[model samples]
Each structure stands twice: as structure tokens, then as C-alpha cells.
Target: MVRTVLVLGGTAEARRLAEALAEAGDRLRVVTSLAGRVSRPHLPPGEVRIGGFDGVEGLTAWLREERVDAVVDATHPFAARVTASAAAATSALGLPFLVLRRPGWRQAEEDDWRWVGSVAEAAELLPTVGTRALLTVGRQELEPFTRLSDVWLLARSIEQPNVPIEAVLGRGPFAVESELELLDDHDIDVLVTKDSGGDDAKLVAARRRNIPVVIVRRPPSPAVMIVSTVDQAAIWVIYGHATVS
Candidate 1:
């Protein structure tokens, strides 16, 4: 018998999990869903669907109609709504559910960092840290930083901010030296980012230059089975399906 799985995917971890499941042959049937926010996302394996499943009610009905045996939410760490919806919908149906959340970054002794509760708070806290800044909080949250217009800003985003910004287009896994050069070239006095961790280059670059950093912490997620990597999630799915079978 084949096991049907639904992966709420948009993160790097999500793509990896889908790849691992794809290697498991016909024993597992995988369908990966994307929010369609990114214009050109890194496509995952197996079956793929774009856009939301409306909301919780819509998702619950879809699960019932599709006969999905398990669900894994591998959305971006900041994607709190999708995560909550997945948790609620799966719990109601007694379906197996898991979240693949990459671990967050830690501040070290050499780092000068201020932890803010939200994006708005991070914007408000910026003036205390430095006068010129680079906002790496992604494109959506760029609006909050506009209030700090007095400070020279260099923002990075794959999509352009609606408002006029000194924006740079790039993705992560940045090299520390490359990050340092960008900062030094722009005369950036601070770096603002979310604590959604993967590579440490940009944060480390700030530390090397003695530039202050304002990090917006992640929002609380709904209680669920959370794992940190693709391997762990894959193991859980295989083990879970075996146990149920």
C-alpha cells in the first residue's frame, strides 16, 4: 500500500525533504504545495501545487478528499499562519503532522546584538544601534523600516520593495568577506535581520566590522512535532507510516 503525504513547502528544508521522499519509490506518494509568493521558487520533487488551500476549512476538506496519510509543514520560519493552519487542520483529523524548522541563530560574546520582539520593534530599536543600516528582514517587512527614513538604508530583497529603497538583489549563504565588503562600501553602521538561521555570514560580517545588529526573533509557532533537518523529517515519515501500516 502506498502512503500519501502533503508537504506545505517553501523553505530549503522543505525541498530537501521532498527530494528524500521522492527517492523512496512508489511506497510513498508526495505532493508539495507552495504559497506562490516567490515569483520563481526552487521547484521541489514529486507532485507540486502552487497557492494556498484557501484556509483551515479548505485545507481540511482537501486532505479528506485526497486521502493524505501525513503532513509536513516546511515553510519559512516566519510563516506562522501556514504553520498554525497545518497544526489545527491535522489535529482535527488525527493525521500525522510534523514541522521542519531550521534552528535559529545564537548571539555570541563578540557580537553586539539587540533582540526585538517584532519587525516594528526592530525598526524602532535601530536608531539606538546605528545611523546607517542595511535591512535584511526580507521584502514584505520592508515597510516598517520606512519610518526610519532619516537613517540611510540599504535593503536586500529578491523582489523590489514597493516604496523606493536603496535595495540590493541577492540571496543568502553569503560569504563573511562579501558581506563585509557590501557593508563597508555602503558605509553601513548596522545590520537588521530576522533570527531565521542557516548560514552565519552576514551576522559574522557585522561582528567583524563592529557594526551593531538588530535581530527580530521568530513568532511563536503552534505546538507540534518539530524537527530541525530533512533527514529527521524523512525518518519520522518512514517510521510513522510503517507503524501505522
Candidate 2:
């Protein structure tokens, strides 16, 4: 029987996992569910569904209706709500579930990293760090920084933010040289970002310029089986088990 796998996706790891599963032959039916937050999102291979599945009830119904055999959540680390909903829905159905989360960035001794629990905490600490700040915590996350009248905030996002702040529109896998130029051009003394983990180009730029960074730590998540790499996630989906070490 061809088992159907449902991937709750958004991040780069999710995209890569879809590609990996697509190449694994005809034993699996791969369906990726996107949150549709990005206007022009990079799509994955196989079948795709956009938007939320409402809450736990909606998702549970969808899973039952679609007959999803296994679920893999490859969403952003900050997307705790979706993760929780997926966990609950899958648990109630007694279906196989996995979380594919990439490891967070490590701080070198030379890197001046100020870790905060939330965006609000980062907002409170921003003024003390520097006068000019580069906010890379997504467009929706820019509200807290908006209230900081004393600090000059420049936010870079894939889409234009509704909030009042200087905007730089771009996407990632950014080169370090370009990031260096952006920091230099903006006269950014400090940087505020989330610990999204992969691609340390911006962090490298900050370190080169000797700028302190206010990084928002990821929130606590529900206990579930998790793997850090796409290979592990693919293994779990295919073989029903992943060697987590």
C-alpha cells in the first residue's frame, strides 16, 4: 500500500525534504501544507495545499478525510501554535508525527549576542544596544520595534510591512559580502534577529562590523519526535524510524 505523508511546511528544510521524498520513488504520496504567509512562496514538489487547517479540530478532520498516514512538521521554529495544533490533532488520531527543526546558531566568544525570550524583551533591550538597528525578525514581528521612538529601526522582509519603519525588501540565503554592504550602508550599530539557525551570513556581517545582536530565542514546544536534518526526516517518513543521535 502507498502510504500518504503530510508535511507541514514553510522553511528551507521543508522544501528540501519534499524534494528528497519526491526522488524516493512511488511508495509514498507526498503532500505539503503551507501556511501561505508569504505572497510569493517557494513551492515544493508533489501535491501542495495552502493556508491554515483552522485549529486542532479542522486539522484532525482534514487528516482523517485525506487519510494521512504520517505527518512531518517542518515549520519555522517560531510557529509554536501550528506545531501544537499538529501535535494535538495527530495524537488524537494516533497517527505518526515528526518535527524537523534545524539547530540554532551557536555564539562565538567574540560574537556579542544578547539572547531574549520574546520580541517584547528584544524591543526593551534594543535602545541599550545601539541607536541604529537592523530588524530581521519578519514583517509581522516588527510591531514591538515600532514603539521605540528613540531608536532608528530598519526592517528587511520578503513583503512590505504595514507598520511604520524603514523597509528593505529581500529574501535569504544572502551572501555575506552583500549583508556587509547592507550593514555598512544602513550605518547599523546593532542587529535584532531570531535564532532561525541556518545560513549565518547576517551574523557573520554583524561580527565583522563588531555589532551586538539581540536574538530572540525560540519558544518552548510540545514533546514530540524531532530530527534536525532533512535526511533524518526523510528516513523517518520512509522507514518509520530515524536514528536520532
Candidate 3:
């Protein structure tokens, strides 16, 4: 029997999960949903849908309408609302749900890191730490830091940020060499970023420069079965159980 799976995607893991599931041949029907936030996103293999499902009500209706047998949320960790809605919608439908969350970066002994609960809190703490900051917290989350008059800010984004801060546009999986160049060229004294996990180029660059880093912690997510790797998540989607890998 073929099962229809809905994957809430936007991250590299999500794409990888979709690719893995697509390799299942006729056994499974995979549909990946993107947030449509990026103007040009790297299209993943298999069927793809763009934009929001509105909220829990809309998501529940979509799931029902699509006849989705299971759900895997591999969205950005900071996407709290989307995650919450997915959890709620799946619960209401009694569907098998899984969360693919990459583990967050660990603070090394040499790294000077200030952990904050939210982006606003990080912005508040930035003034006390350094005069200039390199912000890698994405374009949407930059509003909180825009009001700071004392600290000079340089931000990076896939698209231009709405705020007045100076920004360099680029997409991720950024190399440490490029990161080091960015830090050195800017004379950056501090780095502001979210705990998106996986790659740690910026973190490494900051450590090498002995610069302080203000890390915005991920928001609390709804309780769900979570797997830290694509292979584990793929196993869950296929066999309905997480096996030791």
C-alpha cells in the first residue's frame, strides 16, 4: 500500500529527506512544502508545494484533503509558529508526525558566547558586548537590532533586508575561509546569530578572532518525535520506528 507523506521543508535536511524518500520508488508519495519566503529557493526532488497552510485549521484541512498518511517537519528550527501548527494539525488528525531538528552548536572552551532567549534579548545585550557586530540572524529577525544606534551592524541575507543596516547578500553553507574574510574585513568585534545548528563557520571565525558571539536560542517547540539526522528521519518515515543508526 502506498502512503502519502507531507514534509514541511526549507532546510538542507528537509531536501535530503525528500530525496531519500523519493528513492523509495512506488512505495511512497512524497510532497515537500516550502514556506515561499525565499525569492529563489533550491528546488528539491519530488513534488513540491510553496507558501503557508495558513494555520492549524488550514493545515489540518490540507492534510485531510491531500490524504497525507504521515508528516515530517524539517523546517528551520526558529520557525516556531509553523512547527506548533504542524504539531497541532497532526495531533488533530491522528497522523504519524516526526520532527527533524539538527542539533545546535556547542560552545567550545575558547568561545565567548552569550546565550539569550530571543533575538530582542540578543539585541539588548549587544551594546554591552561590542561596538560593531556581524549579524547572521537572517533578514526577518533583524528588526529588533535595527534600533541600536550605538553599535554598527553588518548583516547577511539571501535577499535585501527591510531594515537600514548595511547588508551583504548571500546564501548559506558558507565556508569558514569566507567567514574569516568577512570578520577580518569588517573588523567585527562581535557576531550575532541564531542557533540554526549544523554548520559553524561563523562560530569558528569568531573563536579564531577571539570575538564574543551573541547567540539567540531556539524557541520551545511542541513535544513531538524528533530525529537529529536525515537517515533517522527517513527510517521513521519508512518503518514507523526510529532504529539505532
lDDT of 3 by residue, 1-245 (tens): 88999999999999999999988888899999999989899888989999999899999999999999999999999999999999999999999888899999999999999999999999999999999899999898899998899999999999999989999999888899999999999999999999999999989989999999999998986778888999999989888655435
Model 1 lDDT-worst window of ten: 236-245
Greater TM-score among 2 and 3 belongs to 2
Local distance difference test values of all predictions, in order: 0.88, 0.94, 0.92
**Which pairs of residues collide in candidate 3?**
none
Better-scoring candidate (lDDT), 1 or 2: 2
Ranking by TM-score: 2, 3, 1
What are the models' TM-scores?
A: 0.95, 0.98, 0.97
Native-to-model Cα distance after best TM-score fit, residue 137 in candidate 1, in Å? 0.9
On residues 1-245, what C-alpha lDDT tens digit does candidate 2 reach at each position? 88899999999999999999999889999999999888889999999999999999999999999999999999999999999999999999999889999999999989999999999999999999899999999999899898898999899999999998999999989999999999999899999999989999999999999999999999886799888999989989888755555
Scored by Cα lDDT, where does model 3 land?
A: 0.92
The ten-residue window of minimal lDDT in model 2 covers: 236-245
Of candidates 2 and 1, the better by TM-score: 2
199 Cα displacement, candidate 1 (Å): 1.5
Give the winner by TM-score: 1 or 3.
3
| Candidate 2 Cα errors over 4 Å, as ranges | 242-244
